[model samples]
Target chain A: MLDNSMKLEFPSKSQNESFARVVVASFAAQLDPTIEELADVKTAVSEAVTNSIIHGYENSLGIVYIECEIKNNKLEIIIEDKGKGIENVNEAMEPLYTSKPELERSGMGFTVMETFMDHLEVYSEEGRGTKIKMVKEFKSVSIKE
Target chain B: MQLHFNVKDENLIVRFTGELDHHTAQEIRNKIDNKYKNDMLKNIILDLKGINFMDSSGIGLIMGRYKTTRANDGSLVLINVNSRMEKILTMSGILKIVKVYRNEDEALHNI
Candidate 1:
């Protein structure tokens, strides 16, 4: 039984986006993901974390929390932020429907997550927060020596 | 993130050697826009060979540049995009709008 999990809490700063991505990718590495699979997890994590820092927290400062778990050959990640939540998750997920066009947002965050991860779920409430849970399963898992 | 700029003919070729995401998009955009404005290049070519990772923010950056370049009556093209980045760009359906070339020379010749 190889089940491992970790938690992280950091400021919702734009710079932390890359930090979060790298951390989750490192955790998922335990499953022996391929280069492409690793890249996929990194991209998905980046998107979710960016969403929390940008759309969720907006201009205000808040905390971004991340929890990662490994079970079997699947990696599960949950990125949550207690900031301004999405009014409509469905509309937000629609590709190219950016609410911040002035900021040059392509509105592909949710789309990218769905594309890269095996499963994706988003939960949010106005004036509350947003939580994104994503999972990726490695098809070829090798036991470590 | 670092952006290396070079002017060839009427094109402004920018080589990006870092990850492209929301955090670095603004700085990179500002630099490219400044160069494009000052040099008055007729076309913009992005060399993505050095980019290791990207997200939707990269899409926004490219789209914004495409708009600015087109407004100048110019064109914007991409070169050396790896397979991983290609997958993200493909999902954005941006490949349909902006052309991608195998290399800078090919891009320069075609555009």
Candidate 2:
């Protein structure tokens, strides 16, 4: 069995961001990261959640399932949504390329995900869904006495 | 997120602590722009070390400041970057225009 792993589900929205954060934090606890690292994880989670809401659901209603795993001292997060999947994952990952600029998205969600995490992989198809998987290794871990 | 301003050597440094989502970007842009008019600003540095989360709205803020700083014949620098934020900056290629430093001291000295 994996020493650190978790999964959660939530409706896509700003308020549900906390739910995603909590899940990531729980899985990241073993890494014993500094407060800054913890914040980084949460911010990455926020971006993934935002994408699930904005792009996956396309401003409609949908469920987001998040799964996190800690292996070899690295944290991996997966955000999945069954909505209008991205037709071109590459275009969506580009910076400032949101389909809904009127919503003021800045279209940087995937960029942030790619930035904060050590590794990122996106899977999606039009009219299907999108799954964002991210990994981050804690550069520093605290030791408890 | 709210902002904290630190002024030294006539350079204005803004530290953002909180989420820079779409809802807050416009107000932040206005506030920072207003500060420029309020004083004879020389250089500006943004200390994003405390920023936990940001979206495209955050990008807009940085781009706006880049423009504002250039118009005044000054420069803008961003410091205390984490990986996630670094990725965003890299993707946006803001590094091509704005300078990013590891710390405020470094940014201040170089600016």
Native A-B contacts reproduced, model 1: 0.89
CAPRI class of candidate 1: high
lDDT for every model? 0.92, 0.78
Candidate 1 residues B1-111, lDDT tens each? Answer: 999999998899999888999999999999999999988788999999999889989999999999999998999999998888889999999999999999998998899
lDDT of 1: 0.92
What is the lDDT, from 0 to 100, of the residue B29 in candidate 2?
75
Cα error of candidate 2 at position A23, Å: 3.8
The numbered model that scores best in TM-score is 1
Per-chain TM-score of chain A in candidate 2 equals 0.90
Per-residue lDDT of candidate 1, residues A2-108 (tens digit): 89999999998899989998988888877888999999999999998888888899998999999999988888899999999999999999988878999999989
Per-residue lDDT tens digits for candidate 2, residues B2-111, read 98887887689998887776546667777887786687797889988888776555776787787788898899999998887776677777788888899988988899
TM-score of 1: 0.98
Q: Report residue A42 deviation for candidate 1 (angstroms).
A: 0.6
Q: Which runs in model 2 stand beyond 4 Å of their true positions? A: A34-40, A101-107, A137-145, B3-15, B22-57, B65-91, B99-111
- The residue-by-residue lDDT of candidate 2 on A3-109, one tens digit each, is 57777887776677766776787678778787667766877787778777777886698899988877766787888999999988899888778887655456777
Which number leads on lDDT? 1
